[model samples]
Target: MADFSSEIRQGIQHISESVFMRLCEKVGTSQRVAMRRETVDIKEMVEQQLAPNDGTIQMLSGSDREGFRLKGSDVDHMYWPNDHRVIMDMSQSEYYNMANTTLILSDSSESPPGFTLLQLLTPTTDIDVLLTCFRINDRVFISSSIFRQLTYLASLPNSDIHGPCVSGDVAGLEYDDTLCFVCDYWPPSASSWIDRCQSWPDPEVVDDIVRNGCHFVAVGHPLGPHANEEWRLSFSQAEYKCVYAMNHSQFLTYGLLKLFLKEVINHNLGKNNTLLCSYHIKTIVLWTIQQNTLPHWCPQNILVGFWVCFKLLLKWVREGICPNFFIPQNNLFLTKVNGSAQNRLFLQLHELYKKGLACLLQSSSVRSYIIDVLCSPRLYICTDESIIKCEVDSDVELFSEILQNDKTLAQVFYSCMKYLYKVQQLIGSHLTQNQVVMLQRLTASILKNSSFILHNMYTYTGVNKQMYIADKISCHMLKSAAKFGCVSDMFYIAMYYYRTLRYREALSVIEMSKVKLAQPYLMYREHVDRDRYTEAVGGQSWSTKMRKAVVLDIILDNAICYINELIPEQQAALHNKQHMLVIPVFLMFHFLEFLCYRHIDTTLSQAALDELQVLVHYDQGLFVRDIFRDISWEILGICQQITGNLQAALYSYQQSLEQYPLNLIQTATHTRIQDVVSYSQNSN
Candidate 1:
C-alpha cells in the first residue's frame, strides 16, 4: 500500500509536470493562439463596426478576459449607447421609434415607467441582439412592472424563447455560427450588488473588484426562469482575481480536478453526457479553498487535495444540492441532477476510490498514450476536400426515420458496478483458496459478459428488470465455478485481495499469476480523420447507404447515452447529428487530454514569468494575438516590476495602454509603469 502511495505520487507529479507541460505547448501554439485572436478580433471588429449606428460596443464578459478561456471558444459582447439618457428617456409607447426598421424584429414588448425589449438580428454575427431600456442610478433596479414585461416577452416568437439566449441556429439567421445573445441595461451598473459583498470576501479583493465595476447580465430566460428580465449581478472579475491569488500548486489542483471531471468521468466509457459540468467543479474548488487553510494545499499532498475535491463532489451527490458559491440560496444543482442519478454517480465514485491509486497511477508513457488518443486532431478539424465533389441535399424524409433509440453509456457502468459489488460481498467471508480462485474467475466473467447485457439493454426497451435478474444469476454461477482450477482466476483473486486490504496476499497472487496471465491490453484507438474518411468512402451523394451508416452510428451513441442517463447528472440533449454518423463527431477526442494538460502551463508560466521569458518570446502570439492582447503586456510589466526590471515593465505597460485602453485597466497599468520608471530613476 505504501508502495502504491509512492506510485500514485509519481503519477501525480507526471500529471502536474509532464502532462501540464504538454498542454501548455499545445495551447500556446500558433494555431490555437490564432483561433483565440481571431475570435477576439471578430468580436472587436463587430463591436467597432456596430458602434457608430447602434451604440457604444463593449465586451461585457468572456472567459478569455477572465483568463480561463480555451481554444475555439466564443467571446461575449454588449451594446450600450454613448448617451445614457437616449434609451432612458424613451416612454413605453416611444420604444418603437428607437427601433431600426430594417432590422428584422423577432419580438417586441413594453413595460410601465418606460422599458422596451426589441429582439433583433444583426448583420455580422447573425445572432440575436437584445436592446432594453432602463434607468441605472446609484442603486440596482428592482421594478415589478419591468420584470412583468420582461417575462411577457417570453410569449413572443424568437429563436431563443426557451432560455435567456439561443445558440447554433433557430430561425431568420442564415449563418451556422453559434449565436451569443446580448442584453443591455440603460443605467447599467452592478455597483449595488458589488457593495453587498463587502463583509463576505477578503475586503481588498472586493475593493479591487468594485473598482473594476461589474456587469448586470440578463437572466430572464425560462431555464432558471426567475423574475422577468432578472439580471444577475456578475462578479466574474472578482472570481478571476480569487483564482489568480492561489499558489501555483493550488491552481494546479483546480486544473486537475477539472480534467478529472472532463476526461476520467466524462470521456471514460462514453460518459460525457453526465450532469456534472466544469462550472460545478470550479465552484466546489472555490468553496474548498475558502474554508480550508493554506497548508492543506501543499504540493506533496496533491493527491489528498484531489481526494478532498472528489469528496466534496460526493457530498454534493449525496445531498443532491450544490449551493451557489456567492449566493447560498441559489442551488446550482436544483433542476440539473435528479436524485436517482445522483445515487448512481455516488456509487460509481465510491467504487473508483475504493479501487485505490494503483489502478490510476499509469506510467508517463501510458499517460501520453491516453492523452494522445484523447486529444487526437481528428475530433476537431474536418479537412475533407471532397466538399467540391460532393453535394449535400436536405431530404426531410431521409432523416425522418433516423432512430434516436440508443441509451447513454452510464447504464453499462451501473451494471458493471452491481456485479463488482456482489464479488466484494462474497470474496472474504471465510472462503477457502479454491473458493477465492472461483470468485476471481466469476467476477472476470461477469466483467466480460456485462457488455452483452448492456448492448441488449440499450437496444431493447424495458430490459433493465431482466438485466438486473441476469446480473444476480451470473453472481450465483461464480460460486459454482469456485471448484475448478483456473489460472486466469488468479488475476481476479489478486484484485479482490487488493480491494479488501489483503495487500501481501494480493501481491503474492499477482506474482503467482505472472507466468500464466497475459499482459492486459488497452486499445486507445484513434478516430478516423476527415481526409482518411473521405478517401475510404470517396466523394458521394447522400444515399440510403450513408443514411443506414448514420443510423448505426446513432445506435452506438444511444448505447453510450443510455448508459449515461442511468446516472443523469449530465444535460439531457440528443447527441449532435455529427456524432451519429460514419464521420467522426467534430474533430477528435484530444480535447479531453488538453483540458488537464493545457491549463497548468498557463498558471505556471504566469506565476513564473521570469523563467518563462524565452518561451513567451517563442510563443509571442500567445501574448499578442489571443484574448490577452491588451493584458499580456500588462502582465509582462507586472512580472518585470516584481523581478526589479523596472525599465522592461515600463515598456510592457506602455504596450498595454497602446493596445486596448479601458480607463480603469489603463490607470492601473500606467500607475505600475510610472512607479517602475520612478524607482529606476531613483536607483540611477
Candidate 2:
C-alpha cells in the first residue's frame, strides 16, 4: 500500500510539472514580469509628471502593478495627500514640518489589530479634512466613514465605493482609486512581520520595507468596536516590493491561485458572494512563501507550490480565521468569511481537495493548459530559456497594445507640452532610471506632434521668411523625435515633406521607412514575428530591447497632422471620445505615398491608391486596431472621392458607417454619401 501511495504521488508530481510547463506559456514567464514592472513604473512616472503639484502622491497598485494582465482585472490607484501625515505617536511630530503638514496621531489602543484611530494633532483650515473630523471626548479624530463618504463624493461621475477604493469604469476598463493618508512609521502591529521575514526575504529587503513605512486607508474592521472611527493600516508599498522580489515561478504560482479563485471558486459562488478575494489569495501566497512552506518554487514545482497554498487556504477557511500576513492577530475572515459562508466555502474547498490536481481543470482560464499537459506529456517541456523567449515576444505585443491604449496622439501632444517644464524637473530629480527612458519616448512623441501642429499653423500658399523659419524649426523637431522614437516615427518626417509638397524628399523618407518597417523585429500594431524577436532581442535587457526593438504605429492627429484637403473628414473624426482624428501608421503611410505620387507620378499614385483600398477593405487587424476601423474606412472613401470614383466613394462611406460608431464619423460619412449623390445628379 505504501508503494502504491508513493507511485500515486510520483504520478501527480509528473503531471504537475507538465501542467506548470503549460502555465508558464499562458501566465507569462520572467520576461513578461520584468516588462510589466517597467510598464507600471513608466505609467506611475507619467501620472506623477502630469498631476498638479497639489501635495499629493499617486501610486498604481493591485494586480496591474503586480505584473498580471489578466482580463477583467481592475486598475488600482492609491492617492495620499502629502499635507496629511499619520505618525505612530506624538514624539514623531518632530519629524514633520508642522506648518505645512496636518499631523495625525495613530491611536490603536481602542481599535482592532491592523486598525487605528487617527487623532488630529493640529488645527487645519482645509475644509475637506475638517469635514471628516469630529470631537470624541474633546479629542478630534478623523471618522473613517466620513472620509470614505467624502472620497466617494469627490470621485469620478459614475464611481461607487468599494471598500477603500472608488470603483468605476472608464473607457471600458474598470478602475479602483483609493484615497488614503501616509504614515511614515511602520505600524507596531505589523512589526513582528519583519522578524518573521528573517528566513525568507533577505535582510536588506526587510529593512527597505520597514523604512518605506505604511499607509492608512479609509476603511475599518467590520467587527471592531470603533469601526466608523478607525482606519485600516495598508502595507501596499511593502507588498509591491515583496511581489517585485518574487521568483518568476513563484509569481506564476500566485497568478495561478488568482486564476483559480476568479475562474473556478468565484464562478461557483457567483458574483454576489464575496467570501474570498484576490487579496486573500495574495495573503496566502505571501505567508506560504515567507514561511518557506514549499522546498522549491521552480516551474516544475509550481503546481506543488500552488497546492500547498490551496491547502493552507482550506485550513484557514475551516478555522474561520484568515490572518493578515503582516499582523497575524488580525483575522481577515472575521466578517463575510464566517457563519454560513465559512461552512459553504470549507465544504467547497474540501471537495476540491478530494479531487486533488483534477480540481484545477475547473478553472476556465487554465483548464486548457492542464489538458494540453495531459494530452502531450512527452511533448510538453518548458525550460526557463524557452519560456523567456516566448514571454519576451508576448511582452512586446502587450507593451505595444498598452502604448496604443494609454497614449492618445492628442493627449500626448498636449499633456507633454503643457507640463514640459514640470516634466523636465521631475525627470532630473524624481523619476527612476527606467522612468527617464519612458519620458524620453514621450518627449519624442511630443516633439513629433508639436512639429506637425506648428507646420500646419505656419503653412502658406507662397514660401516667405516666416514659412522658412517655421519649416526649419519643424524639420529640426521631426529629426530630433526620430532619434528617441521607433522606426515608424520616421514616417512623420516623410509626412512633413509630403505636406509641404516636397515629393522627392517625401518619397526618399518613405523608402527609408519601408526598409526599417520590413525588419523582422519591427513590431507594429498586432504584428510581431516571434522567431525574429527571439533572434534579435532575446538576450538584451528588457529596457534596451524595448528601446531598440519594439516599433509603435505612427499616429496622425486630425487637429495637427491632417492635410487641408481632408478638412471635412478630419472634422468628423473629432466627434470621437478622444476628440481627435487618429489614423494608423500603415494607413497614413499608404495615403501619403498616394498623395506624394499624385504630385509627381500618376502611375505610382494609382498603385498607392489601390494598395490603400486593399489595406482598408481586407485588413485582418494587423494594420489598424478595431477601435479605429471606422476612420480607416473613411480614409478609403475620401481617397476614392479625391479620385472622382463617386459610386465607389459612396459605397465606401456606407461601409465606414457600418463599422463601429465609436469613431463618431457617421455624420461625415453620411455627408460624403449625400455629396456623391449630388455629384451623380449634376453629372446626369
Candidate 3:
C-alpha cells in the first residue's frame, strides 16, 4: 500500500512537470523573459530622455512594466516632480538645496504601519502644492484629499479617481496615472524587511532597493485617524526590481497564480466582489521566495512552487491576515478581508485545495495545458530546442508590435534636435548589450525623421550656402539612418533621391529596398511568415536580427516633413496637436517607384501605377492597417488624377470618404473630388 501511494505521488509530479513545460511555452521561457525586461527598460529610458526637462520624473509601473502582456491589464504611470521631496525628518532636508526644493517631513507616529502624514517643513512657491497644504497644530501638513483632487484635475477628460490613481481610457487601453512624491530615504517601517532578506535576493539587490528608497502616494489608510491627511508609502520601484529579479519559472508561476485568481477565483466570486488581487498573489510569492520555502524554482518544480504559494494564501485567508511584503506588520487585508467575507473566502480556498490538481481545470487560460498533461503521460511536449524556438518567435512578435506602435516621429518633432542629442548621450552611457541594440534602432528612427524635417526646412529657404549645407546634412543623416535602420528604412533614401530629381539614384535605392524586403525574415507590421522566418534566421540571436528583421512605417510629420505636392492632404491631418501623415511602406514604395519611373520609363511607371491601383483596391489588410485605409484610397486618387483618369479619380475619392474617418483626410478627399468633377465638366 505504501509503495502504491509513492507511485501515485511520482505520477502526479510527472504530470505537474509536463504541465509546467506547456506553461513555459505559453507564458514565456527564461530567455524571452530577459528579453522582455530589456525591452521595457529601453522603452522607459527613451521615455525619460524625451520627457520635458521640467524637474519631473515619469515611470511606468504595474504589470506592463513587469513584462506581462495580460489582457485587460491597465497601463500604470507614476509621475512626480523632482523638486518636491519627502523626508523622514527635518535633518534629511539638509541634503537638498532648500532654495530649489520643497521639503515635506513624513510623520508616521499617529498613522497606520504603512501610512504617513506629510507635514510641509518649508513653504512651497508652487501654487499646486501650496493649495494642498493647511495649518494644523502649528504645522502645515499636505492634505491627502486635496492633493488627490488637484492631481485628478489634471487627468484626462471623463477620467475618474481610483485611490491614488486617475483612471481613464487611452488609445482603447485602460490607463492609471498616479501623482506621487519621492522620498530619498528608505522608510523605517520596512527596515525589518531589509534585515529579513538574508538570502534569495542577494545583498546587492537589497542595497539597490534601499538606495532607491520609496514614494508617498496621495492615499490615506481607511482605518487610520488621519484618513484625509495620511499618505501611503509606496514601494513600486522596489517591487518592480524584485519582480525583475525573479527567475523565469518563478515569474511564470506568479503569472499562473494571477490567471487563477482572475479565471477561477474571481470567476467563481464575481470580479467586483473578490478581495484577493494580483498584489496579494505577488506578496505571497515574495514571501515564499525569501523564506526559502521551496527547494528549487525551476520548470520541473514550478507546480510545487505554485502549490506552496496557494497554501500560504489559504493560511493568510484563514487567519484573516495578509501581510504586506515590505512591512509585515501592515495587514493588507485588514480593511476588506474580514468577518463573514473572510470566512467565506477561507471556505472557498479550502474547497479548492481539497480538489488538488483538478482545481487548475477551472482556469480557462491553463485548463488546456492541464488536460493535455493528464491525457498524454508519455508524450514529451517541451524540449530545450523547442523552448528556444518559442522564445525566438515571441521575440519576433514583440519586435513587430513595438515597430507597429512606433511614435518616434511625433517625439522627434516635439523635442526637435534636443531629443536627438539626448539619444546620442544615452547610447554613449553605460548600457547592457540588448539596450545598446534597442537604442540604435531608436536612433535610426529619430535620424530618419529629423533629416526629413531638415530637408523640409531647406525647401522654405533661398538657394544659398545655408541651403546647400542643410541639403548635404539631410542627405548624410538619411545615409546614416539607413545604415542602422531596418529593411524598409532604405525607402527613405529613395524618397530623398526622388525629391531631389535624381531619378536614376532613386530607382537604384528602390531596387535595393525591394530585394531586402524580399528576405524571408523581414517582418512587416504584424505579418510574418513564421516558418520561413525561423528557417532563415533561426540560428541568429535576437539582438542580431532585431534591426534587420522588421519593417518600420514612413510617417510624414505635417509640422516637419512638409512636402509642397502633399500640402492639401497634409492639411487634413493637421486637426490634431501632433499632425501625423502615416504612410505604409508598400504604399510609399510603389508610389515613389511610379513617380521616379515617370521621369525615366513610362512603361515601368505604368506598371508601378497598375500595382498601386491593385494594392489600393484589393488589399485585404495585408499591406495597410485599417486606420490607414483612407490615406491609401486618397493616395490612389492622387495618382489617378495625375494619370488623367478624372472619373476614376473621383470614384476613388468617394471611396476614401466612405471608409472610417480615422485618417482625417475626408476634407482633402472632397476637394480632390470637386477638382476632378470640374475638370471633367470643362473638358466635356
Q: Each model's TM-score, in the order given?
A: 0.36, 0.73, 0.81
| lDDT (Cα atoms) of all candidates against the true structure | 0.41, 0.77, 0.79
**How many pairs of residues collide in model 2?**
0
Instruction: Determine which window of 10 residues in candidate 1 has minimal summed lDDT.
Output: 583-592
Q: Tens digit of lDDT per residue, candidate 3, span 1-684?
A: 133386666666676666666666656666666656676678666665566534567788888678776788888989888678899877787898887788889999999899999989976777778898888789889898998998888655667898898997744678889999999889989999988988868788999999989999999999999899899999998998999888877888898898888888888665468889888999999999989998678766666777889999999999999899999888999999999999988999999999976888898877876677677767665545254455446766567545633546233444657767777677667876656666667677777787777776767678788778987888898898787777777888887787777889989999988888778767776578877777777767555566567777777766654344577887776743226778888998899888889888989988999999999888888887676778888888888888898888888889889876654677788888888989899999
Put down candidate 2 lDDT per residue, 169-269, tens digits, no spaces: 75478899999998878888888898787777788888888997999999998888988888999988888889988998788899899989988888856
Better of 2 and 3 by TM-score: 3
lDDT of 1 by residue, 65-152 (tens): 3333343333433433322212222342243333442232212122211122332222222112322333333322333234333443
Provide the clashing-pair count of each candidate structure: 32, 0, 0
RMSD of 3: 5.0
Task: Please rank every candidate by lDDT, starting with the best.
Answer: 3, 2, 1
Instruction: List the candidate 2 regions with Cα displacement exceeding 4 Å.
Output: 1-6, 42-52, 82-84, 97-109, 117-159, 170-172, 225-230, 364-382, 385-395, 401-443, 446-477, 491-522, 529-550, 553-583, 586-620, 629-684
Q: In terms of TM-score, how similar is model 1 to the real structure?
A: 0.36
Inter-residue clash pairs, candidate 2: none
Model 3 residue 272 CA deviation (Å) reads 3.1
What clash pairs does model 3 have? none
Cα-based RMSD of the predictions, in order? 32.3, 6.4, 5.0
lDDT of 2 at 552: 68
